[model samples]
Target chain A: MSSTLQSRWWSWGFRSAVMLYFILLIVFPILGIYGYSLSAGLAAFTENITEPLAWKAVLLTVKLAFVSTMINVLIGTMAGWVLIRYRFPGRGLLNSLVDLPFALPTAVAGLMILLLLGPQSVVGQWAEQLGFSILFHQPAIVIAMVFVTFPFVIRAVQPLLEEMDGSEEEAAYTMGATKAKTFVRVILPAMLPGIASGAMLAFSRALAEFGAVVLVAGNIPGKTLIASVYIFGEIESDNITGATAVSVVLLTFSLLILWLVNYLQSRRKGV
Target chain B: MHVEVRGLTKKFGEFPAVNDVHFSIAKGQLIGLLGPSGGGKTSILRMLAGLETPDSGDIVFHGTRVNDLPPQEREIGFVFQNYALFKHMTVQGNIAFGLEVKKWPKNRIKERVAELIELTGLSGFEKRYPHQLSGGQRQRVAFARALAPEPQLLLLDEPFAAIDAKIRQELRAWLREMIDRLGITSIFVTHDQDEAIEVADEIMIINKGNLEQKGSPWDIYKNPETPFVAGFIGESTIVEDVSTLRGFEQAADWPGTKALIRPEYVEIGQANEFRLLSATETGRVRHLHFRGSEWLVEVDVGASRLVTYRSLEKEVLHPGEEIQVLVHRAYLFNDNDSWIMENRLKEDPMPVHI
Candidate 1:
């Protein structure tokens, strides 16, 4: 090639290399799984996708994700509210503690949850006596998921809470809003987008969490087996097709969640 | 409403943002809580608004102690330094927010919001969001929002600080007229002395968390009670020695306390043989400066202090030329009251930081 053409070719070559790396790292595996899911054509798609066990896994995952997301949104809003707007003795320590989930590995987090609610810890014993089976149950999956995804909602919402002009709440108060009413009317509407976006992020993260869920959920087939654990089991049993099918369902759901969150974010930005 | 603050002190960490400040604001007066930056004007405003509580002392509104009441229960209006417009809300919605919080009737809110938009001259801008308006327009929106609900007391924290200076002067005058029309008791906090003078019925000049002086603008300018007030309110130099000019016009009547003079009152060529120990050159072409309708010319004495003179006509003088100067309006005060002296017969020789 001529020198000018050589430079053009080199730039094109670099672009191809980067594209190939993405394909190898992410897109290739996804494509492989998608192909495997569709290998049996319409028959395999119908059979694997709508299997009773597979349906249970999807249902359980959705229920856990939904409940965890709601709880996280509520508690995370309060947590973020405190972290940004209040000055307590351990304010700095509490601020750092919010980032614990991200800093702690999911496996370690799962173990900590297990230890706390595994019928051995004080809380776990009390919980069992109170007629709640926290560990080795569907609630165990939820507890594990909430633990891994707690900070997502708090971290996402806290900055937005901090960015808000505190004067609005004060204005509400000066105009005769009680503390609760001020938060409900003036503060909540403004914080809704952040909370919504954060909850969605947490939901997606919860759906993908495996290490924590596997430890807490004892992998009982019809009772405690979650989507991630289901995928692990299929892979271990050499049923790559089943693993790919389960993953495809999760991938689609997470994408839908993120898209909804992106819509909320865009609306907030437009404000 | 008449408001009295006694021994109001606010400490942020260890630094006292507002010291033991005591000032009673008369009802229906548009007063300015004037101070420089870090002088605790805003802190005092916040405390009065019930957004901040004093570590000691109490605030009494009318006859009732209000420190224990929440801000909403205080029935007071606060306009923040930048106007604090809700960016998400349109002009109409922003104005209506306060009334909505009060849970005012729908019809009343609509009528009130409309009236406010009209009063603030934002008639066609009701649909615009805060970000869509100019700085002055946002200011008007904030004003409209604060006044839409009939508050017993209105507190403005540096309301015009964000606007351009030209707009600020016009707005300051307009604000005074508006507040007077409502006959509302308003305490506006500002660091600009000129803004306070131009806008307030009475101004409370504060410094370093203490109320230095409180009086009408004329009184403050004509007779500043303290050195801080005198220095902050007007443009005049404190000379090292102005002893003989002590009672001034009352010189033969009763020799009052220590001496002082206004720069404008010190007339050049008004008298002769008034002690020319410090004499300097003044030429018709050298020493004149235009001061609006007047010219302020300087005649330097041997001691390096330029006694300033004012005249409507441009009386120019060249440098190194002869000119006679005299003191017409001079202030006499007790030595103990003054933070510093221009001259002294039995002066204590104290250090003064300008």
Candidate 2:
């Protein structure tokens, strides 16, 4: 009986220690930001968020994140399907390379994109000849966001494809479904949950991207300056309330998106 | 449709899953491809359904060569072992998928799906997903979905293998009756001999990627063409030498000394109860197993251990008791040949002094 009581006390101590650490590391900082955003009163918080530059930056962040999420969904779905269904030379190498973007520093990724699409590069010269510019514009911001979040959708989709039964495709074929129809009707629906959850994660990551966007977006007001860069600019200028308010907005949006992804995943498992 | 396969062969890497196997099925006949696991039964069914390509063969359906036809155009319905019902679709939606693919009218598809739901005894499960149903219900849904488009042939790869034993028996009978009513050429693969004997109109025994024999259940049971078929179809014991047994000494002259003796071919009785006492040999009882309606008695006759059944109505015999044993018939076989050999005493039952 004494030994049981000792183990119980040990478990209680361990639980409280981890809980205290989580609160001190994550919960306290987020609550502090929210509290600081409201420290100057509700009117000040509202005025700071509604400032034309701040609002425009948030809108531009959402728009570019949505665009990058769409691009990732298309490319990632194809890459996942090919990787799971086909056999080829260098397949193992290619599969391992998919996680490279996740492993590399986002700032390094931004520098690479800047170098590849800079005005002096071959791609930049070709784009200039076509009467358009890529670097230091919204397109370059989207490219950086795409690079940083490239692995999310593919990683999400690969497991779903692997878990899928091969006989399901054969059943559809025997039922008079063409290859295209089988993919659209049977395979796509099975992969939908993964795609949706991955896209949401990618969108949230893109929204908060600062290291990569700051290098190539030029940080122009009302054009390419995203919400994260704007918050950094406010912090540099000593406007703590403005930066905290914008951070609160991004935090709230990320929380909602994460909740949505969890809900979708739970529903898929339940079915 | 009348189905015929000529020289069908399938290879996986260097291993031959199916090697030069051939068979034909009459229209409306239910054929069971019975074999041990990894014996290419499923490969044959998949080839017929056009799910797997034969390395070199002709799959002729109704006198037309379909070697190049895709599964969608082959007009064959396949039921996988796990059913493979669309998990995301409701029962009604699953049953209507093939019809929709065939471009059936919307109302017609609805009507056919309703009819099949009722036919498969899933009257109120039309809106239920595959995960929400029992294994038997899932199998019925798969059957209904495969039959929705009215294909010419049906191929099932171990249709009842995934269900519980009780439900498996029920589904076997239900499948046989359903196939008979539909009058569609159907072939199902199974490793169970009893299931094949009970459900299939004809049984094709496959072994080592070869078609060993194909016949009706009664014929296959009565006359197994190959040694494998004889050993596989019924319970029997293989003895290395038959010359030591009474009245089976004539079988020693056959090319192979090995012989298969079934329980029914041996007769056991008391010393005074046997009418053919002159032709009988005294043996000691080794063991007895209770087999529901009878006692399976194992006897030690010289060096050979023989098994025979005693009716429950007869007096119980204890182990180590001496009993008169009479040999009637045995299947003598070698690696490539087999034939039944009857006891010489039964042919000429005159009192013979040994």
Candidate 3:
């Protein structure tokens, strides 16, 4: 083969390899799940999804994910800002620990939370006296989801904050702006894209959380049973169609969130 | 408003970034804090702007002591070296930020912003964000924003440091004109001596956290008080141990004296009334280069190389040729303890390693 033709052949080969990997690993599995879920016809798919228990499980999961993502956006943004802006003795250690959730197994995180906040713990006993049960309830599911998704917002926002020039904040202060106003008008807008990306990751992670949630939430059907737990219960009962149907809905929600995150990131970069 | 910085000192850990630096600016005067990088010029500017707190000092603005005041309460406008225009804000929004933060009425803000936009020649860029603007354009936006709230004092940290050379000259002239028209007490820090000379009515030269000289550009250039100012502010060849040069006065009383001779003050191929041709100093030409308008000729005087510029009208001199040069005036300073010699002599002269 001529040199140009040989190089072109290699380029096409690499391109095809990448496409094949995506097809086999991602596209094929997603398409199979959707096809299998709809194999029993649209009516059966709709009926399986409309099961009151399944609907409640999806709602609970979404509510919990939304709440936890909101919390993450606040606490994670503050954590990221503090880590990037302030100099403390253990800052380096704290910065590395932000990625602990990503490195640790979800089951281990669940057990750690269970041991720290379960009924036997001091904080858990104090909470129990206040007529609130953290374990085996909606809060437990949220706590587990938060633990597994803890790094999302912090990781997403930390680098941007680190790269951010503090001159703008200094400029604001020179313009007679209070610290609160500077953060709101100047700092927050600059961080919005990072915060949006982080919130999306937290939301998606919360939506799909299984190992941590299953251990801490106790999988009480219709009350604490999240969408992932509900799908697992369906599969255990030999209801593959129902499980796949609920998976499709959860996947769609996650896809929408991913699209939003991409949109925000692109817009920020374009601006 | 006039601003006074008295006995200002700041230390970063063991490093004294600005030590006992004191200077004051009159109302509506434009002063330039001129120095090389890490010379404490920026630190002094920051302290005056209330951005950095001094270790021990009193920053008084118009008789009011603002030492402990926060930057927001200082009523100062600061333009950062990087421009620091808000990336997410439009030109108008950036300019109007100060006014908006002060809670000015919407119509008043619009009016003020439009006026500033026109004044800064940014009429067409009102809707554009900082990233979309060029370096010069962003600089104008930063200036307009700082001026929006009508600050009592304006501080700029290397305003044109980031601009291209050609644009920097233009911006420097334009900024000086604008500041004069606004008549606000302003001080800008710059490492470029040329920029400081061209733009500032008064230039304050600092070196290694010490204030070397503070005067008008002409005065500072012509009459630098110390050897540091003479060498830093303009092109000067500092000859320590002035007794080394031939045809120099013998001063046994002051053994370690340094003489500063500016390149322009060294007359080549001519004898002035002070020194006749044979009586004047003679040095061999080491190298010569055309400096666009003049030729920069370096002549070796045995102990030191003397740098002087030859006008285009002068005859071209080659290497190894003896040239007669006359020094119109020389500034002398007591080189009591040269830092380099002291460091070489003492094993641990610097108590603080930093």
Candidate 4:
């Protein structure tokens, strides 16, 4: 009994210490960004934000995130559905392949894409001849972002689909409902919360992606370069104030979307 | 309505689950599918509901072959053992699902939902989710949902298995009244003999993927067609090698090959002269349990033993008492009586399981 009590105290102290360590290492840096952006004066924040080129980069970043995140959610939901509901040849291998981005380093993923579509690769020459440039363009950055976030939505919704009781559908079928109607009316409502959470995570991950965006954006001003890459350029040119302002803008947008997503999930549970 | 199952067989890989079983349920009748666990009662219900198709054979519902139809295409209502209520929907939503699936008029759906909620005694709880209710209440909601579609044949899989024993008893009577009031043809599967006896209009006893008997509760208790049905559905005592008595086969006049007697039919007084081993009841009373009015006693009669409930007027028999027991009417069965029910009076009732 005394040993059990001792172990309980040990676990409590160990968790508190580990939590404090993470708060200091991770939370402290994010706090520094927020403090520097807000406290360095509104004049600096407005002056840095008033730049048209930086504003254009922000717009491009939003568009890329929207386009890529939408495609990822749609395709990933279908992939999750098929993996959980069906048994096909090579299913295990396909499931493992979905996790390739999680294991592949961001720089290495960018390098691999550059090798495949760097104007000298097989598909790149054909695309060039067709007057459709895929490399060193905004579209190329979206493609790389998609490749990195593909597994997020699939991994999130797969367990939800598998854990579904399946009796409701059977019960619906016995009620003389067509299979299509049962899916639309009975199955989809139950899956919506899971899908939304997955989509939000994918969107946040896509917005924060910089390595792949950097390799493909080519740092073109007012054309192909994204906000993260533009921030990188401002730092390289000794403009820390402008870089901090841009970082804060991007951070606030992602945080607002995440907060909305969490609100929806908790409300769904209440229902 | 008048469902006929001919040569129904289902197999899962190398396991032969439901063999070539044959049975029929007349219209407006409630039939019991009674069996031990894994005796293929649920499998038969699934086949009848069109959720599962037999490997070979035909299931004729109202004289139409429905062997290949999916459950959605078949007009059936299934009450699951666990109720299987939608966790996301309220009681009203669950009942309205079937009407909505049929694309009924909006006002008609509302009227029907209100009627069913009232019928199932869930009017005030229509907005409550399934998890917020008791087991009995959840079962009532499932029943309401299933009957909302007004199915021709209602199928239930152990509807009372999830409720507490007391609540289950009350719900059994309510279920029978509700089903009879609607005049719906129904089939329910249960491993409980008392539940089957209490609720089913006719009982179908199944053992090891085979139909053992199909009869009323009284008939099943009075004369079981098979030994497994007899031993399983109720209590029985086996007095082996009783052919030693002179003219015992003719004088004793048992219908089948062996002599079997129910505990209630056995008397505890004088022994007959043609008795083997002095018609003895030399048993050591192992234990006595107080069961309200009567006492249930466990007696070790020789090498074999059985339980008997006897009345106590303050002259109760204690442990290690020597007494006399006699059988007035005995049943007879070998082992294969289920495979051939037409010959329930035959000399050999079943092939020995051993």
Candidate 5:
């Protein structure tokens, strides 16, 4: 009986320690930000959010993140399909290279994009000849976002494709469905949940991207400046309330998107 | 439709999954491709369905070569071993998929889907997805979906393999009856000999990428053409020397000394019960096993251990008891050939009541 009581006390101690660590590390900071943002009163928070420059920054961030998510969905879906379905030389090397973005620092990725698309580079010269610059603009911001979030959709989709039964495709073919129809009807639906969840994650990550976007976005207040950069600018100018308010907005949006991803995944499993 | 395969072969890398095999199926006949696992039964069925390409062969459907035809144009319906029901689609939607692909009218597709739902006894499961159904119900849905477009031939690769044993037996009968009613040329792959015997109108035994024999169940069981067939079809024990046993000494002149003796060919009785005591040999009972409906008695007859079934109505025999044993017939075989040999005592003047 004494041994059982001792084990019970030990279990309680471990549980409380984990709970205290989580609250201190994660929950406390987020709540502090939310409380600090509202400490200046709801009117001040609203005024700061509705400021024309701040509103434009948030809008631009959402728009660019959506664009980057779309691009990732297309390229990542194709890459995942090819990697899973085909056999070729250097395939193992290529598969391992997909996770390079996640391993590399975001600042380094930004520098690489800047170098590759800078005015001095061949691609930049070609683009200039076609009448526009790619670096220090919306295109550069998008490129940086794409590079940083390149692995999300592909990593999400590869397992779904791998777990798919080959005989399902063969069954479709034998039932008079053409190859294109089978792919559209059978394969696409199987890949959709993965693509959707991955896209949401990429979008949320792109919205919060500061290291890569700051280097290439030019920080123009009403133009290419995203919400994260605007928050950083507010912090630099000692407007703590403004920075916290903007951070709250992004945090809330990301939380909603994450909840949506969880809901979609659970629904898929339930089905 | 009549189906004929000539010199069909399929290779995976350097391994031949199906090597130079040929067979023909009559219209409306249900053929079972019976074999051990990894014996190329499924490969043959897949080639017939146009799911796999034969390295060098002709797959003639109604006298027309269809080697170049894609699966979509081959007019064959295939049921995978796992049923492969579309998990995302409802039962009605799954059944309507092939019809929609064939460009059937929307109203006609709906009508056909409803008809199949009723036929497969899935009357109220039309809106239920594959995951919501039981294994037997999932199999019925797969069958309904494959038959929706009414193809000329049906190919099933281990159709009942995924179900429970009791349901497997029931589905076997159901599938055989369904194929007979549809009158479509059907071939199913299986490793179960009893299932093949009970359900298939004709059974083709495949082994190691070769078609060993093809015949009706009774003919295949009684007259196995190859040694593999003889050993595979029944519970036969292979003995190295048949001349050492009583009445089978005439096998000494046979080409091969190896012989297969089934439990039914060996008779065990008491001393007074034997009519041909002169031809009988005394052996000690080694063991007895309860086989649900009968007792399986194992006897030690000289150098050979023979197993025979005893009726439940007979008196129980104990182990270590000496009993009179009689050999009626055995299948003598070698690597290249096999033949049936009856006991010489059956031709003797002594009357045997066995």
Candidate 6:
């Protein structure tokens, strides 16, 4: 009876410690950002965010995040499907390479993209000849965002694809469904939850991306400047309130999306 | 449809999974491929369904060679061992999937799904998803889904393998009845001899990627064409060195031959009452087990032990008791492991009637 009581106390102590750690690390910081954002009142907060440059930065970040996440979901899912299903030489090597973005420093990824497409590489030169610039442009920003966010969808979907039995698709084929139809009906439906969650992570990651997008986007105010880079500019100009306001907005949006994903998954479980 | 597999073979990497397997099934005949695991039964079934391409030989359906045909073109219905029902779809939706894929009219698809749901006894589970259904219900949905497409041949890979023990038996009878009612040629692969014998009209024995024998369950049980079949199908004592067998030395020389003696065929009697049996030899009872309806008594026949059954008579047979075991009948296999003869009454002059 004493030993059981001791274990119960230990469990409670561990739970409280974890809750306290999360409260101090995450919840307190978020509350601090909100408090600073509203220090000068809601009118000052609105005026700070209503600046044309900052508002355009927000719009540009949203567009980049959306487009990049859409591309990531399509390409990453296909890559994951091939990696899990097909047997080819170097498949293990290719599967391992999908995590390169996660392992590499985001700034280094940005530099690598710069080296490959920044008016010097062969493809970059060919694009220059075609009268289209890829470096320090919208495409480069999107590309950098995609590079950093590539692994999220693939990592999420790969495990799911591996866990699913191939017999279901085989059954579909024997039942007279074409290969394309089988993929669309049987395989895709099973992969949706993974795809949706992965896309959300990629969107959030792209939304908050700083190092890679700043290097490639050139941070042209009201043009290629994104929300994070705009906040960085605000911090550089000694405007902590402006930066904190934008930070609270991004934080709240990220929290909302995460909560929405969790809600959707729980709703599916309820069904 | 009448299905024929001619010299079909499949190899995985360097190992052959199904080697030169050949068989033909008449139209509307329900056949069972009975074998142990890794015995090529599933490979053969997949080959027939065009799910797995054979390395060599041809698969013909109703006189048309379908060796190069893809699974979708072959129009085969396959029920996976795990059911493989679409988890996201309702039972009705799962059944209608195949019809919808084939571009059947919406109303026709619904009508066909309803018919199949009723046929598979899943009328109340039409709206339930695969996860909501029980194992047996999932199996029925798989069957209904496979059948909804109206394929030429239906193949089931261990249809009753995943259900509970009691439900396994019930589903076996239900599946057999459903197949018979549909009048569609179907073949199911199973590792259980009892399941195959009880459910299939004809049983095909496969071992180590080789087709050992194919016949009715009764014929395979009684007159097994191979020593493997004899040992596999039913309970029997196999004596490889037949020369060591008591009262069989004077028989004709069958080099490398083995003899199979079924338990029920060996009649046991008391040592003093040898006259009650024909062609009798003396042996002591090594062990005795009361099997409720009968006694499974093991007799030490000199070099080896022979297991034989005895009725639960008034005199219960006990261990270490002297008894006379009559070899009423036995099967003999040749050197190449093929059935040579069925040694019946008055067969050899080796042992005399006591």
lDDT of 1 by residue, B1-354 (tens): 999999999999999899899889889998998878999999999999899989998899998999998788887888888776776678998899889888899999999998898889998888887878998888888888888779899999899989999998888888888998999899998888888888899999989999888999998887788767876875665544444342222333333344455576555653243443233123222366777777766655433354575656534555656765544454545545653223221232354668
What docking grade does candidate 2 earn?
high
Q: What is the TM-score of each candidate against the true structure?
A: 0.84, 0.95, 0.92, 0.89, 0.97, 0.93
lDDT of 4 by residue, B151-250 (tens): 8999999989989999998999999999899989999999999999999999999877888889999998877777777778777776563343212334
Each candidate's lDDT (Cα)? 0.80, 0.92, 0.86, 0.81, 0.92, 0.87
Q: What is the DockQ of the complex in model 4?
A: 0.63
Query: Tens-digit lDDT track for model 2 on A177-240?
Result: 9999999999999999999999999999999999988999999989989999999999999999
- Write model 4 residue lDDT over A19-132, tens digit each, in one string: 999999988887888788768799989888879888888888888988888998889989998988899999999999999998988878888888888899988899889989
iRMS value of model 6? 1.1
Instruction: Calculate model 4's interface RMSD in Å.
Output: 1.3
Model 5 bad stretches (over 4 Å): A1-11, B350-354
Best-matching candidate per DockQ? 5
* Model 2: how far residue B334 lies from native, Å: 2.0
Proportion of native contacts kept per candidate: 0.68, 0.82, 0.96, 0.80, 0.90, 0.88
Candidate 6 RMSD to the correct structure: 2.9
Give me the candidate number with maximum TM-score: 5
TM-score of chain A of 3: 0.97
In model 3, what is the error at residue B67, expressed in angstroms? 1.9
Better of 3 and 5 by DockQ: 5
Residue B52 of model 3 has an lDDT of 92
lDDT of 1 at B43: 90
Off by over 4 Å in 6: A267-271, B241-249, B271-278, B290-293, B312-314, B337-354
What is candidate 1's CAPRI-style docking category based on DockQ? acceptable
Instruction: List, for all models, the DockQ compared with the true complex.
Output: 0.49, 0.80, 0.70, 0.63, 0.86, 0.73
Ranking by lDDT: 2, 5, 6, 3, 4, 1
Q: Tens-digit lDDT track for model 2 on B1-354? A: 999999999998998999898888999999999999999999889988888899998999999999899999999889999999887899999999999999999999989999998889999899988999999999999999999999999999999998999999999999999999999999999999999999999999999799999999999988989888988997899889998888888776774668899888899979877776867899999999999989999999999999999998987899999999988888888876788888877655665779
